[model samples]
Target: MIDTRMIGDVRVTRIHEYSGPTHDPKFLLPDLSQELLESNREWMSPHHWIPLMNKLILTVQLWVVHAGSNIIVVDTGVGNRKPREGMARMHNLNSLVLEWLEAAGAPPDKVTHVALTHLHMDHVGWNTRWLDGRWTPTFPNARYYLPQDDFLFCESGRNKQEGLDVFGASFEDSVMPIVDAGMSVMLKPGMEIGDCLQVEDARGHSPGQVAFRIRSRGEEAIFSGDICHNPIQIVHPEINSGYCIWPDQARKTRMEFLASSADRETLVLPVHFGNPYAGFVRREGAGFRFEPLLW
Candidate 1:
């Protein structure tokens, strides 16, 4: 189920669902080659790998949103019963997130907007659900938002989605319905939905990837999609995940995000990384480190 928290007047929620070995330890390590690690001085640190193997499973967060007039879902996460690639092993379909939303006073039908950080399988799985023998948009009344560049890059057909089918059907089954229904919004940087929300250019992780900046009741928060996978990644922004389409650009984006906002009191909502949703960035050494806020 999803956990809920309120930052001033803005309500932030997250769906704790995923598709993978719940207790796998390998995800904690940077997706780097041994040779690359050996040659790079920056990647060599005690914090390079977490010692508590058992805690690794707690990482990966499926974030949800209840910002302003919209019940915005940042990433849908891996949906139930969908075939996945890599370590994604999800099952037993249930709407724990919807339950949490109801408990938080936001019902499914009341949701006005659904936003995606990227098009990875895990981020878009819950975008649709199996019903009547077909996948359909879960939010019946909401307008689905996706970056145009991200949509084109993933659906371009130039790259092989050999192991990324979990994310494929979302566009065809889930997202297309909204587009066909006229409830889809494609955004560029600086786009404003209302007085309290704005979109910022946060590319690299995915081309044209954008982060949502929310301001309300004198508080500020940025839903940082996959800018940093783990808290450790904050201090090692140079490390790249195997799935990053453009590693060099991803690395640069990570650095810029850290340098621009880590020291300030901005609340950063990263997609993954165990508990403690919001945090401030700190400069530990050559790289920046995440200081998660304790709830």
Candidate 2:
């Protein structure tokens, strides 16, 4: 299913890729306490957390933004038929991401730009599709904006050496093809796309992870990628996901983003948030609260 919302003149549409019970609350967020989980259980049950299954629900999705003539795609989800042996959930499977994008009103061909928050397997998988005989650039007309640090890091094959084969394989099949096709552009902090989307430093989840800030007519929203996987993090910013490479930095980034979003009343659209995916962060006492955008 797709959810559409207007942020001033820019139209934002979320195209769903995958959604289910993903991880254990304690497993995903090691810093979370049972008391805290139980405290928030009333509001989190069924949507963000499944008490019966002891799993944290997550959704893998991408955002399509329409800014005048620019058809921008925010982080692509895991693509069809990829070798992700290390991560069972992302391994050799087929998903109708392209069809969903089309249904969301932004087809692959119409996508003018692709902005990736990081180079993780799930975020960059749809960069290429198995076409003809090999992996090919899925968005042929789009110039893919990739983080320079991550591109260099993944290109160095260090992730594989460090036993992150899932990311390495994804880089090989998904990202490299974009570079080989000469459609890749290095993204930098404070970079603006079409005068509405601005890139901000959001490193921590990955070395070069960044977030996009969309603004128009005084309204704003942040396409935060994996900074906080679930809304639970809004109330507990210190809890870092197990996948975070730099825990300290990740926590700091999350806290900062949450505080800023709350102060500015900006919409928070994280990649792994459950249904009614986007929301607003509001300051509550010493922490924050998530106000889901139900419309």
Candidate 3:
């Protein structure tokens, strides 16, 4: 079943497009020591940790938010066809992203906004689709609110200097098409798309990385982008994915984000958390922990 739950007034549904092992622990987040995994094995096993392969099981999902007649998407998971070199697992492949969206009754055209927390390959893949021998904006009517800094940064082609040009082609295919289609908007921090949704900058993973805080009748949930990819980071906030462009900035942003989420008892909706893609943040000694929302 498609995981759908009401958060105050917004209907937040998880369209789990893909799930499996993507990165080895050492490669996913090098700072995460084996000792840390062993210490937390009692809790993480079977669901999150794969000891044999040492890979953290993660999911690529898109969160669809229904607010005041607006259908907003937070991150479009890996799209169907793209030349995602080096990332063979989900590259040049077929995906059910759109079909699942349709099954949920939220077709691409009905989508009002496609707010990408950042312009990463996986997050922006479905922003466009292969059409007529060329990539084109997938959501014809949705105004995509991408971060200004990120759009410009990626546009500048500086991602090559950052060493993950693996996403270079993705920018050319998924993002640029939206801009050409005149459906892309540069997001500003504190930008409000609706009374229930507001944007906040959470840079580090990407220059323009942003998170959305949705509030309705005082109930709140945060759509935290790649600030922390897996539940393991909730326990060890210092760890950063190897894809992070600014390591120090990424770590700082993560710890602070976790602290606030824990203090506020906010529901955190992340892009790559495994099975239960949405959860709450809780303080666990000096760090924090993810309490998955089974509902």
Candidate with best lDDT: 2
Candidate 1 lDDT over 1-295, as tens digits, reads: 4566776787787656632224333443446444443443343222333233332323445555665666666767766666543443444345366566577655767777777777766577766777788776777887777777877765675334544232455566555665677777887788865344578887876676788787777677788888776565675677765556677888888888888775555778877665554577877677675676665
lDDT tens string, model 2, 1-295?
A: 8889999999999988899897878877888887899899988988999988889998889899999999999999998998887667888879888998889878899999999999988899898999999999999999999998888878887766666343667888999889989999999888987567899999888888999999888899999999999999898888888778878999999999998999998999889988788899998898898898976
Give the TM-scores of the predictions, in the order they appear.
0.81, 0.96, 0.96
Model 1 misplaced regions, further than 4 Å = 18-55, 58-60, 85-88, 91-95, 161-169
Candidate 2 local Cα displacement, residue 72, angstroms = 0.6
- List model 3 lDDT by residue over 98-179, tens digit each: 8888887689999889888998888888998888999988888789988888888888878878777635677888999899
Model 3 misplacement above 4 A: none
If ranked by lDDT, best first, what sequence of candidates would result? 2, 3, 1
For residue 183, what is the lDDT in candidate 1?
72
Q: Per-candidate RMSD vs. true structure?
A: 4.3, 1.4, 1.3
Least accurate 10 contiguous residues by lDDT in model 3:
160-169
Clashing pairs in 2: none
Against the true structure, candidate 3 reaches a TM-score of 0.96
For lDDT, candidate 1 versus 2, the one ahead is 2
